[model samples]
Target: MPSTPGAGQSVPGTAVPGPGPAWFGAVMGTGGLSTLLQLHADAVPGFATGAVVMLVLGWVMLIGLGSGFARSVARDPQEWSRSVRDATMVPLWGMVSMGLLAVGSATFVVTEARAPSLASVAFGVDAALWGAGTVLGLATALGFAVWLISRRPAHPLPTWALPMVPPMVSATAGGVIARQVKSEAIRSILVGACVVCFVVALVLGVAVIVLAYHHAWFRTPVPVALSTTTWIPLGIIGQSAAAAQVLSGPSLAGLARVYSAVVLVAGAGLGAYAVFVTVRGFVARMPFNTGWWAMAYPLSTCGLGSYFLGWQWASLLTVAVLIAIWLLCAVASVRAIAAPRHA
Candidate 1:
C-alpha cells in the first residue's frame, strides 16, 4: 500500500517515489527476456537458469502490482480509472497482460517433465491465464481507445501505445500455446484469433505512434522520463512479427515471411533511434525511476523479432542483432533492479 512519486516528478540526484505501473516495466522486461532466452535455449547455455530468474522476477512484479493497486485504490477509488484515462499511464494495463504471458511462457519452457498428465496440467494452466489476460487486455485497450477518442487529449505520448500492445502479447503467447494443441481445427481457430489480435495491435499502435511523433515534433520534446516509451512501437512490430512467425499456416506463411522481413528492418531502425535517445537522456542525468523498465520489454521483443527473422532467412546479421539486443536487455534489466526504491 505504499505510494510512489508520479511520473514527471523525478529530478537528478533526488530519490523519487515510483508509480503504480512502474513495476509493469519489470514484468515486460523479465517476461520478454525470458521469451527471448527460451527461443535461443539451444544456443544459449543455462537457458533454464535464466528463465527461472525471469520467472521469479515476473512473480515479484506481479506481487508488486497487486500491492500497488491495493494501495492506490485505498488512497482513492477513482485513481485507477483516472490513471487509465491518463495518456502516459494507460499502458500499464498491457503490462498486466504481457506479464502473465511471460510467466506462462517461462513455465512452458522450463518445465521439462514428459508425463502426459503434467504436460496437460501445465498447458491447461497456461491457456487459462492466457485467456483471462487476453480478455482483460482487450477490454482495457478498447475502453481506453474509446476514452481517448472522446477526450482527445492534447500532447499524446508514445506511451499511448501501451494499451494497444497487450493483445499482441496475448497473440504471441496464444500462438505458443496453439502449437501444442492436437486438434487441427482448434489450432487453426487459435491461430486465427492471434492474427486478429495482431492486426488490432498493429493498427492502433501505429496510430498512436504517429500522434506521439506529431506531439514531439510540434509540441515539445517528450519528457525525459518517457524517452524509453519511444521504444514501444518497436515492441509492437517485434511482437507481431513473432506472432506471425509462430502462427504461420498455409494461409499466412507468405504473409508471415514478408512481415518478419519488414519488421526486422523497422525494428533495427527504431531500436537504434531509441538507444540514441535513451543514452542522451541518461547522459543528461535523467533520474532513475520505474520508467526505465520501459526499455525492458521493447528491447526483448526486438530481440525476439530478430531471432524469428534469423531463422526464417538464415541471416547472420539478424542473428547478431539478436545477440546484441539480448545483452542490452540484460544490462537495462539489471540497472532497473538496482534503481533506488520508494519507501
Candidate 2:
C-alpha cells in the first residue's frame, strides 16, 4: 500500500529547498549546446546569437547551482561523500569541467572577430579551468574506482561510465586550444597532454562500460532516471575521435586517421543502439530529472565527432548526421530545461 502524506509532511508536489550537484547538468547541457553552435556558427544563421544566449545561461546556472551545492555540501559533509561515491553524481565534476570548456569555446567564437586579445585571455582562463578540473576529475574517478572495487556494489548502472569521461572532455578542449594557439611549443605540449588524457579516459571508460553492460544484461534494468546515461559511451568515443584528429600531427597523421575512422564507426553503431534504448525508455514515461541533461553533451560531442570525420573525408553524409544530431540535441535541451518540478 502507498503511504499517505502526514500532517506537516512534505507532499509529492511540493517544492524542495536546497540544491544538489545534479543541477550542474544544466550547465553541462547548455554549455555543450553553446559549443556546438559556436562550431557551426559559419554554417548556421543566427548561431552566434543562440550560442551567446546558451553560454550566458550556462554560466548563470553554474554560478547559482555551484554556490548552492557548495553550501549544501558544507552543511552536510557525509552526504557530500556519499554523493561522491554515487555513480551518477560522480560525473558532476565532468559536467563542471565541460561547462568551463564550453564557456571558453563561446568566448573564443564571440570575441575573436572584435577582440582577439580578449579571446586569448578567455582561452587562457579555459586552460586554467581545464587543468584544475582535470586534476579534480581524475582524483574523483580514482576514488570512485577504489570504492567500487572495495564495496562491490550490486547492479551497477551505465552511469558508472560517468566518472571516467572527464579526461576526454579535457582532451577535446585542450586539442581545440592547441590547434588555435600561436606558439608551436605550447601547441606540442597541449597536443601531447590531450593525447595522454584521451588514452587514459578511453582505457578506463571502456572498462566501466563493459561492467555496466554486464550488469544491465544479467542483473537488473537501469533505473528510468538514468536511462540517458546509455549515451555516455558514445560521448567518450566521439570525443576521443575528435581529439585524436586535432592532435594528429604529420608524424602521427596516418595513425590518427585510422584511429578516428575506427572510433567514428564504433560511435555511430553505439549511437544507433542508444537511440533505440532512449526512445523505449522515454515511451515508458521516464520521469523528468537532472539526468535528462545527460542527453545533451553526449549527443553534442557525437555530432562534433561526426563533423570531424565527415569533413576529413569530404563526405556528404556528415551534413545529414550533423543535422540529425542538432535536432536531437535541441529536443534534449528543451526537455531538460522543462523538467518536472520534483528534484
lDDT score at residue 71, model 2, on the 0-100 scale: 89
Model 1, span 215-265: residue lDDT tens: 776888766656666777777887887887887877978888898888777
lDDT of candidate 1 at residue 259, scale 0 to 100: 83
Residue 60 lDDT, candidate 1, scale 0-100 = 80
lDDT of each: 0.68, 0.65
| Model 2 score (lDDT) | 0.65
TM-score of 2: 0.81
lDDT of 1: 0.68
- Which regions in candidate 1 have their CA more than 4 angstroms from the true location? 1-20, 71-88, 112-117, 217-219, 311-343
TM-scores of the candidates in the order shown: 0.82, 0.81
Over the stretch 182-297, how does candidate 2's per-residue lDDT look in tens digits? 99998888788887888888888888888887777678766544566677777688778777777777898888878888887777777776767778868987644455556667
Best by lDDT: 1
